[model samples]
Target: MIGTPRIQSLPQGIEVGIKALAARCREGEKRIAAALRELEAFGYLQRVRDRLPSGRVITRTIFCNQPTALLRPRRPAPARPQASAPNPASEHTGPSEQPAPEAPAPLPVPPPPPPLPQAPPSVPLPPSLPLVPPPTAPKLPPGPIPRPDELTPELDRAATALLSDLHRRAPQFTLTETDVRQLVPGVAAWLERAAHPDAIRHALTDDPPVPLKRPALLLKHRLTELLPPAPPDTQELAALTHRPRITVTPFQTCEDCDRAFRSPTPGHCRDCREHRAEDLRTAA
Candidate 1:
């Protein structure tokens, strides 16, 4: 099994149990089991039994890179030799044959030395000086705080603009208010992380490596994948005091086509004006 190319090509992290291999190869469990048994008999597969600290036994299957011809059974250890006892006849004869032993001579004692004179007492040392405290660091001046309106509505506007742009560019996706609400948090997170709106738009609109069945799901995935850098610190935000604002243009209905358009003249749209000019030229 280890020598098989198909098994070799499998990822290390992938599960390679009998059932998993069977599913991957589109084979029956019985067939896989039989194949495993054959491999075991051929010494290509080995089972190792482990005793866990919890007293539970577990068996693991190992794939041998090189198969063995035969497996030798473990041999038992040799028995240890016991100590021999003393003979009773030798103990009985020892007292009658041996003579009494003589006592050892006493050792000579040495004389003690005379005591020496005592030394004078030592003088006391002076106490240490007290330690001086360290100087405190200078405080920094407070930075300019942002206006309440400016701080509160940035995330909201960014989210709204992102969703609106997505709808305008991909009308076929048919994004609803519910979807917009659900996707707002993600957009706001990008905005909070200091990502530009154009960057977010590009990330969402870029062609993915694989075809997408669900636009919402793909968008969510891209949002996570293309996460922007973290939000700038207070000092950086203070440096960026001004932000660009969007201006809304009012629309009026064209008299000829009844279509709404932004025009200073307010009488007709570009299309209606073009058509009127063409009509006059044809008549002339």
Candidate 2:
């Protein structure tokens, strides 16, 4: 009997399955498979197939908790003695000189170990088909749904996948096609507004309902209720756009030194202008 999937409490005699191993290792199925292969190659793990009386085949993966057990070589089993065949002439003379050698009986074999426990059934993912209208917001706080700097086909796909996979975490949120279609717009709205896919998932999945008859409606309701305000950049951009625009004072080129000046028409630059003004003052 495997207790919990925790590594610290792994059952002594019971063999752990891939799922339990994954939980213990804190890894996904692919990583667990790779590690299993390495361990098996290094003699730390072994997989055996067993056929039950019910005609069902199951695979058992055994783990060697104490690796040092492999280092010590096991003593070979003792072989039984075999009796020699008797000659026909010896059989006739038998009673006096032809005493037959005694044969040791065969050793009894032990029965095979019992089959492993069956794995749990896998859950189905929610609908992922394209949204009918993507999703519209009910009434969220105002600002902007700051769009991505470089939008890609990937963002929408990721959002859709996140919504579709929600059922895996919460069984109550088994979204149908119509639900996905309806809720997708709200998710899209969140993503466009710079919300992370994970954040969106958390907001929608946090504290799931017990007897959820309509997942889409609840999600739709959350779409507006839990909707976050516009991101910082959007706020900054709004601030900038709302500010007054400044007008520029055009400059003209000086006829004397090719220098630019802010005047209707200047014969020279500031130095020349000051010089002319000083000379005119002296002459007066």
Candidate 3:
């Protein structure tokens, strides 16, 4: 019999299959199956098979709290007695009675079927088919691979000039050939974007937005940010010609103070020009 706690713990409503019940109870499948059979025997659980209209048979489980009425045992039917052979001595009193007919001999049993053929133990199995290999990608046309020493004279000249300028401005931050090699790619990128060498120099020398711990890392970041916009495509340029052109102000740099400023003038900064005028007036 199932314990009260266990019976109470049994899931209600929808049926949880045998595997689920076994998992929940932490018991083996055979043990859970036997337990369920015992419960059914005690009339605690009833299993009913239902045949659907689709010809599919499904077993339905019903739980009962109260014990059901025990079924009566079925009695075996009495076997009929077989006829015995007639006695030869009893035939003398009745001479007129005909002799009993001889019984027919039993038929012989058929021979057993032939044994099936089995494979030899020493024979090896046939080799399996080889797997198909994956398709190879199409070969692409090879282009010239860029090397550090193979840079064009113009690019090489620009890289050297930038390195020399950096050395002249900040001698304490000396760069090695390896450092120059690493920095060349960034300089090349800036050049490719149509940035002037002078502008690259200015950006490198200017006070960084953040303090630099490593010159190489800081220079790389500055070059990336200062990369100029690419030239507009021919199609875009043609499209823009039809639209009204908007005038844009050009930026200027002071020749005397070397400070960048927004102005229509070409040479000295406003402060430098003002100072020069003041000095001239004082002299007069």
lDDT of model 3, residue 215: 78
Candidate 2 per-residue lDDT, tens place, 140-173, comes to: 4543322444445776676578788998987778
Best by lDDT: 2
> For model 3, what is the C-alpha lDDT against the true structure?
0.64
Off by over 4 Å in 3: 1-151, 209-213, 242-284
C-alpha lDDT score of every prediction, in listed order: 0.64, 0.66, 0.64
Poorest 10 consecutive residues by lDDT, candidate 2: 104-113
Clashes of each: 0, 2, 0
What TM-score, to 2 decimals, does candidate 3 have? 0.30
Q: 1-284, model 1: which lDDT tens digit per residue?
A: 32346665787546556877878886778877777777778765655554443556766565543454224332333333444576666676345554344332222111222345578776777877447534564545532211122334768777867876785776544466777766677787777776788888888877654444567766666666666667678887877875666776679899988999986557899899999999999999
Q: Residues 77-146, candidate 3, lDDT per residue (tens digit)? A: 3343455788777666555666565443322222333356886788677988557544674555533222
Q: How many backbone clashes does candidate 2 have?
A: 2
Query: What TM-score goes with each of the models?
Result: 0.28, 0.30, 0.30
| Model 3 per-residue lDDT at 104 | 36
Ranking by lDDT: 2, 3, 1
Superposed by TM-score, candidate 2 places the C-alpha of residue 249 at a distance from the truth, in angstroms, of 36
Q: Kindly report which residue stretches of model 1 are placed more than 4 angstroms away from their true locations once superposed.
A: 1-151, 209-211, 234-284
